[model samples]
Target: MEAEFKDAEIFKRMMDATGNLMSDVSIDFNEEGFAIKAMDPANIAMVLFEAKNSIFSSFNIEKPIKISVSLDDLNGILKLVKKDDKLKISDSKNKLVLDIRGKTKQHFTIPLIDENYTAQKIPQLKFTAEVTVLSSLVKDSVKAAALVDDSIYFTVDMPRLIISSKSEEKEFSQDLSINDNKEIFDMKSESTTRSKYSIEYLTKFLYSADSEKPIKLSFSNNYPLKLDYEINSDAKMSFILANRLE
Candidate 1:
């Protein structure tokens, strides 16, 4: 397996997303694309990473391979690469090679692979409404809600979207409306659906956005929320954050 990236920062960002809730991940590299899936120990959240040929500057895999690795170790190794240096990874048996151009190459030996766990398939969520919103606005809502409680309430009404959280001592709410031009696209709400989710998990998901690019949100009452961040024109990365009702 050989892959190259022009900037190491992009690689760091992808690894950071996995480190939030997952310690280890099962990554599959095939002709179709690259995919990673891992569940938190408590089973409350799941993080997914995906990058396709269109997203990467250069993506080439002679054969498919699946490996389970400690995310922290990978991140640590990736950090060694300088800003402009290219990064490459190749696996053989129990050893992994980390190559940094214009610098000393490093080979890190990890534990033997354990192929015992099964990959959980993300369910096809049937959402009543889907909305497209700016990443910054979503990040702000999560940050504001974090001050009061660990959970946030997401409420979407056509032409307006609201994220609110309250505790016995304090309350906070963020409202984005079509009239204000903050919300880029608002879909008609089929039914008034509200659900509570962990602020930490939602915040991590928000960071997956590359820029002010639109994120697709799908949700149902008391059901898991799906947030998708499109990487390049052809690739997308998503997170399935479970709900904790208020």
Candidate 2:
């Protein structure tokens, strides 16, 4: 089997996103494309990734396969690819090979990591509130929260999305009003919802995404927060973060 990515940057972004939460991942390659569903070692955060076959310039497969590899290993090679380089990938008994071709050529191989854990199945959660806002908005909020504490409180209402954090030393909070910014494209709620999450994990996800892209968020009081973003034209990635229990 051989696969080619027209834009290596997209694959790099996906790796960056997963690497933030996990060191190793079991990636499934099928006719549909590539998908990964994994939980952080601490089981505090879950990440789901899906990139459709259409997104790749060329994708060929005889049968579906699952490969375990270190996110750091793949990211390392992708970082070396030139802006216009097309990425070609292959796998063998115990290693994955990457060929980066553009004005110049580069080749690298990484030993596959052995994975013993099974992929997790995420449930369909019903959230009381939902909102779509620019990724930069939440990214900035997390940055502010990090200055004060390790966790941030997300308070979502019909008219606003509030982020707050406090520690013994200082407190910080930011209210993102719904009506003012066009970046807040859509919002709906039967009632208000609030939850606290680790700013560290939230920043991991945010930093991997495009600042201008829209992020759809869903949550309920004291429940896990869900964040979704379009990885590309045909791919989408989501994260489910366990709420901080006080």
Candidate lDDT values, in order = 0.74, 0.86
User: Model 1 Cα displacement at 223 (Å)?
Assistant: 1.4
RMSD per prediction, one decimal?
Answer: 2.3, 1.4
TM-scores of all models? 0.88, 0.95
After superposition, which runs of candidate 1 have C-alpha atoms over 4 Å from their true positions? Answer: 55-60, 103-112
Q: RMSD, model 2, all Cα superposed?
A: 1.4
Position 158, candidate 2: lDDT: 65
Backbone collisions counted per model: 0, 0
Worst 10-residue stretch by lDDT in candidate 2? Answer: 114-123
Candidate 1 C-alpha lDDT tens digits along 1-246: 766665556657777777776777677878766787767777877767777655445667888988777877887777677766777666767755567775665555565367555777776778876778877778877888899998998887766777899999999998777778655566556877777888988887776676577887888888888888766555567788888966
